[model samples]
Target chain A: MEANSSPLHRGPLIAAGILLGAGLGGFVDGIVLHQILQWHNMLSGKLPPNNLIDAKVNMYWDGVFHAAVWVMTALGLRLLWAVGHRRDVPWSGRTFFGSLLIGWGLFNVIEGIIDHEILGLHHVYEYTIRHLPADLAFLGFGLLLLLAGWALVRAGRTDTTPAAASH
Target chain B: MLKLLATLALLLAATTAQACAVCRPRVEAAIHAPDYTDTLLLLLLPVALLVGGVLLLFFSPTLFSWKPTPPRSTVAP
Candidate 1:
């Protein structure tokens, strides 16, 4: 490559990774927390799932949530494809992975704030009368993700070139 | 693609419709009993914000900066 080669943009890859990461993270939430653990439903706070009918209703909303994340994942894949075709997009795993962490953490933070706290839609663990502890823990985890992701993303800046070519 | 999506849609519809033969209507009724619009908005809020933030970053990652993006190549000193 020439010395003055066009600068490889980091935005696209970051975006792609974030979307992909968040989408997959959302699936984990739906599958593990919502389904497997049965911690809480999409609207468990609003309508407690103490009975069969109510539980199914929550399940239905969970499906909808999954569908939205599915769309996000698809969009991320499309963005990745587009970035691959471009000669000016860096292919740094650090950048991408970092972005993914950011996405997941972002999901947790935003969802934690809006749904869990503000809307009172649900808590991390719904079995107890006091839901603050679990909810705070979830937010704490998200902050940790953000910090880790920031480090990786900063490190990725050193990786330049289309495919990490030697200077 | 169209056919696959159609089939999946049909399957999803079918499964949701028949989860419980006896109380399917009751479940559906209960779910839809509330103001449908409000429920949907609330449910979609998180995903929407998440998607929006990512898109903003994808378009402009400047919000989070590094030591400036390294050049694609450099002439070795």
Candidate 2:
């Protein structure tokens, strides 16, 4: 029998998964890029590196960008939890984790494209660009992420819809 | 848990130190300096709230409603 699902069960869980994936991934980008590698700053976060303008302007915007990402991450997780259904929430464990992977991949792709290519802000690695390989590789990583997210999303949808699966 | 806590503490320390030098200029134009993280952090709360509110409005009713249909009562003659 095809059981009906509610928004509480579907929407928030999915949204939260997506948001958490994005936020955590973004944070990792910040932590890794800024601290571990020392290629950027915490203020820079995931935004484009400051080379187009003076250092001061770059510093201001970089900090703003980092704060923005941090806020988004925190809120995103809360929203995910708040929006998910109590009874029908996807806790098959497998599906939840799979979605997380997909979501993380999706975040990487979207951020990579918008921040790196479209904005001409920065690359995945610093001081090693100006070549086709680096640019193409960056874009490729994003594409892969989107595809992975799409697959996981589809999987989650299918798992939830048992009746649909039968047909 | 300890690792996570320690990492978070480190991150907080780093963020604070990094932000101190640059957050003022972004908040005030008159300062003639760069400081955006502080204002950005200040703004983060409202934005996160708004996003959370939207998510709640969208999904709370469907996801959180725990009312169960009551069993029909049987009458004995």
Task: Indicate which candidate wins on DockQ.
Answer: 1
lDDT (Cα, tens digit) per residue for candidate 1, span A3-96:
2345457888888888898888888888889989998688899878899998998898888888999999999998887777765666788998
Q: After superposition, how far is residue B3 of candidate 2 from its true place, in Å?
A: 36
Q: What CAPRI grade goes to candidate 2? A: incorrect
Model 1, global lDDT: 0.82
Compose the digit string of candidate 2's lDDT tens values, residues A1-167.
11333321455555666566656766676677655675543223343344423344445544565676676677766655543434455443334555556555655555555555554455555555453465567557656765776666556654443212322
Say which candidate scores most in lDDT: 1
- What does DockQ give for each predicted structure? 0.30, 0.12
Clashing pairs in 1: none
What tens-digit string does per-residue lDDT give for candidate 2 at B1-75?
Answer: 999999999888774645635655543452243444454443244335434644663455564223222223422
lDDT of each: 0.82, 0.51
State candidate 1's DockQ. Answer: 0.30
